[model samples]
Structures are given as structure tokens and as C-alpha cells.
Target: MLQEKIGGEAAVDARALVKTFGDKRAVDGVSLTVPAGSIFGLLGPNGAGKTTTLRMLLGIIDPDSGTRSLLGHTQPLDASSEVGYLPEERGLYPAMNPREAIAFMGALRGLPLAEGRRRASVLLAERGLADWEKKPIRSLSKGMAQTVQLLGTLVHKPRLIVLDEPFSGLDAINQEKLEALIRAEAADGATVIFSTHVIAHAERLCERIAIIAGGKVAFAGAVDDARDRLRPVVRLQTRAEDGAWRAALPPGARQVGREWRFELPEGGPEPLLRALIDGGAGIDTLSIERPGLHDAFVAIAGASAAAAMGEGAPE
Candidate 1:
């Protein structure tokens, strides 16, 4: 399928990307487009080829087949200075102070060392790490070190930022802070893409998302479009017992406690309500509940992905 480009030129455009390790096909024919100035999410369970696809896009590893364009450059290395990346594995010089560490990363991306240090001071102060800026990275907590590394990713103010499993070890508070930081980046007109197995972060932060499973793209598009694949559920509780009125219930209706829960069929709830009333049922309550991203993820990615999610493996 031809990948759809958003906003004229995509920040990242990858087509038919494939990768293999020995005999195992790690990534097979994945295509994705991330619009400029948007928060795009690559979501999948562990070992679903998300990291492989990302590595290919960043020119870290060659794809067995397919092509990619990053920041309008067909060759990612040509635009390397314009992109900031945070790998799934975290690394920072244990002996370096937070300020020096951030500046060093920014310097590698072409930002002047003095300016990098200036921005680092401002960022650290704003993030409530002012007192810790002079401390060695080894002295900071895990969450603090993660935050500092993320600061490094943003210090150069690249046009595109890519992060892999960014929230892997963050506490609830740090996760919230990172979410806000991602929004702030997009707000500043920088395109952002992050890979994760967690659904909540994607649901809350991304406007568009791609779901991958078993080394292939299962679904990709707007979050709402994915959710719309499944219809809203209609839950009804009627005082009437098993009778002609019971036949008015939807085909998939099943009793859950006192309520009959089923998906709302075509033509919507009005028809269902009319059918129940016409059949002389005493309606106690009725509700139409929209499905969330979790429901969409389950429906699109299948049982195994959902099971992995339940196990907290990656999704």
C-alpha cells in the first residue's frame, strides 16, 4: 500500500522496511509516515519488530529491503544533525555532571558547547533539577537520570525527535512529566515519534499511531479511526423477564449481571429502544459506551497481543 504523507512532507517516511536476523525475520514489510509537528506512536508488544523498524529508519541498521526518508533527506545520515534520538537502552556517563552530560550530547548534534550548557542550566532549573545539575549522574536516582538523558535529546532542538520505550522505567510522576515534555516539543513545531508497548501513553499522547505484532503492521492511522473500527456497546437493563421483548435485544446480547450488554448495531440505539418499547419491555436503564484504545488494540492486534499486554511484557 502507498503510505499516505501528511502535511505535504512527512518527518519520517519508511516504505516496505524489512529486517532479518539469521533465519528469523525480525521486521517484515512495515511502512509508516509520521506527519510533521505531530506526536506519532509506534506501538507493539515486546519482540514485535518495533525496535528493528526504528533502527532501520534511523540508519542504525540496514533493512534487508525497502527505503526511508528522514527529515526530507533520503539518507538519514545527511540530516543526522537535525534529528535527536533516545534509544530503548539508556546510557549516560556515570562520572559526568548533569549539565556537562547534556551539553556534551548537544555538542555532538552541532549545538555550541557554551550554548548547550546555557540551555542545560535553564532546562534543569525548569524541570526542578536545579540543585542536581552539578551532581554526578551516578548520584541521581534512576528517574532523574532518565530525565537528564531526555533533556539531552531535546537540548539540540532538532527538527525531529525519536524515542524508543521512553517510559520504560519511569515512575508515575516522571511519566506524567515526560508526556508534558513531548507535548511541549510538538507545540514547538518539532515532530516526535516514540515506540512503546504501553497503550495508555500512546492513547493519551499520540494523535496518530501504528500497531505492530508478529513482525508486521497490523493497523495504522488516527487513534479515533482505530477505535471506530469497533462499535460502541449498548448496555440495557429491563425489568421484563424472558419474553417477546427479549427477542428485541441485539443478536450478541449476553447477560452480565442484571444488564444485557451487546454492541450497538447499525442504525443505532433509537431503533433498539423503539423495538424494546414496542415489545412492551420495562426499561430500567440504557447506555451507549464508546470503546477506548485498549478495546481497539485488542480487536486489531488479536488475543496474543492482548495477553502480552496483560502480562505487562511491552504493550
Candidate 2:
């Protein structure tokens, strides 16, 4: 079990969450917890029921079975004012100007129209959309419109923000901007839960992550803990290849170019290092590489999930 870090109650919690559509189980027994003031990622491939899980947690859809608590409210709607959700389906009135669009969304979340408009103007200016604040959503670029929508989600100053596929259609520059915004929100003591098929985004921004595959939680914990599932790898370069020194290598050690790469044994690298030095192998360089989140995801969630992420899953 993963221990809660932020004290008090969890910002968001779901237990054995289940959802179904006809005969197909869209989400099966998914569960996750997000600590307050932390960036938590729900990572999975497309159509992996990530959206379904998020919707259920937000009270946007009823789960077939299971329980959820959002911002300490058993009924998510009771805390709706404190929660902000940006769905996978992006929608904004094409005819509405950026400021109007933002204020409208905020209004739906129970913010006063004047206050929403005020916050919208400030957010638009801060996000470099000041020049286009009066322009209709139809006139703005896709990236710019998406930014406006995200600003709307924040206009009400929600304590818990849930974003679904937030980086789906963003360019490199805009994606970086969004990442910074998420970090800023967490820094301001808000809990951010974002779902993404892109592994790199989670690897970069998430302190904790729950990887879902085939509608199930494959792994859930701190990023470091997930990566720790795999052993550290050792790469050594040596000029000596004598019979005595060969015995010092681990069982699975293999030569690739000038380096011998192998997984460090369970006893640790000290034993291997000692044997190599004692055997007089002319070691030029030795380095241990820690496994990354991508490796952990593949090892834990299986290759199919990794493959589904496709180009979005960066090394």
C-alpha cells in the first residue's frame, strides 16, 4: 500500500472503481489516490478507460460499482466548487471571444460572471493571449484556443484540477507551457490529476503515477518506486579478456562494442567489482545506470500498453 504524504484526507480517492458499457467493461476495478498539493498522473494508452475513470471520480458519470471521495466529499458534486475538470472532448463556443469563453466556463462552475471575467482577463494576459482576448475562438489557432479553455478551468481557482489528455493536440512550445502551469498549480497547494497516453509528460511532471492497462491498475506509487521495480544496470569497459577475468562477469553479461553490459546481481555490484579488480581486468570505465519510468512501465504494464502509447512514449 502507498502511504499518504500530504496529511489529512487525500485530495482525491477512488476504491475498486468499476464502470461498464453494455457487455464491455470500460473500467474494471481501478483505484487510485492523489495526495494534496502533488501532481499525480493517470497514465495509460488510448481507449484504456482513463477517461472513464476520471469521469467517475469527478461525478460526471456513475460507476457501476465502487466508491470515490473528491476533496473529502463522498459525493463529488458537494465539492464541485473546489474541483475543476477539463474533459477529453474539447468544447468552446466558436463564436465567443476568448474572455467570454473563459468567463462562461467559470460561470458554469458557480463563479460570479464579473469575477470570472476579471480572472479571465488576468489569465489571458499572463498566458500571452492578451492581444487575442477579444478575438473569437474560431479566429484563434488550435493551441491558442486550447490555452483559453484551460484558463477557463483555472479561472475559479479550483483546489483540485483534473485534466484529461491535456497534451493531446499541443505543439512542443505549448506543451511546455502547460507543464509549467501544472507545476505552478501544485506549488500553490492545489492537487493536479492529469490523464495522458504520453509517458514522457508523466515522467517529467508527476511525483506519483498510476499506470492503467486493459482497464486495470498495473502499477501505482512514487515515480522512484516504480522505476525501482527494475534493477540497476552496469556497463563496464575493459581491455583484458583473460579466462580468469571472464569468470568475474555476471551470468547474463554480454559484449556490446567495447563495453560489457549486464544487470547487477542481487548481491550488489561490490562482489562483481572486487572480482574484476582482483582478476586484473584492465577496467577503463564503469558506470551504473538506473532504470527509467519507460522501462518500468513496459516491465509492469506489459509491452502491449507500451506499444499503444506509440510515439507519445519517449525514452
Top-scoring candidate (lDDT): 1
User: Quick one: RMSD of model 2?
Assistant: 2.0
lDDT tens readout by residue for model 2, 136-231: 899999999999999999999999999999999999999999999999998998999999988889999999999998899988889999999899
List candidate 1 stretches off by more than 4 Å.
1-3, 311-315
User: Cα deviation of 135 in candidate 1 (Å)?
Assistant: 0.7
Candidate 1: tens digits of C-alpha lDDT, residues 158-229? 999999999999999999999999999999999999999889999999999999998999998999999999
Clashing pairs in 1: 197-314, 197-315
Q: Identify the candidate with maximal TM-score.
A: 1
Report the alpha-carbon TM-score of model 1 versus the true structure: 0.95
Models 1 onward score TM values of 0.95, 0.94
**Model 2 stretches with alpha carbons more than 4 Å out:** 1-5, 241-243, 311-315
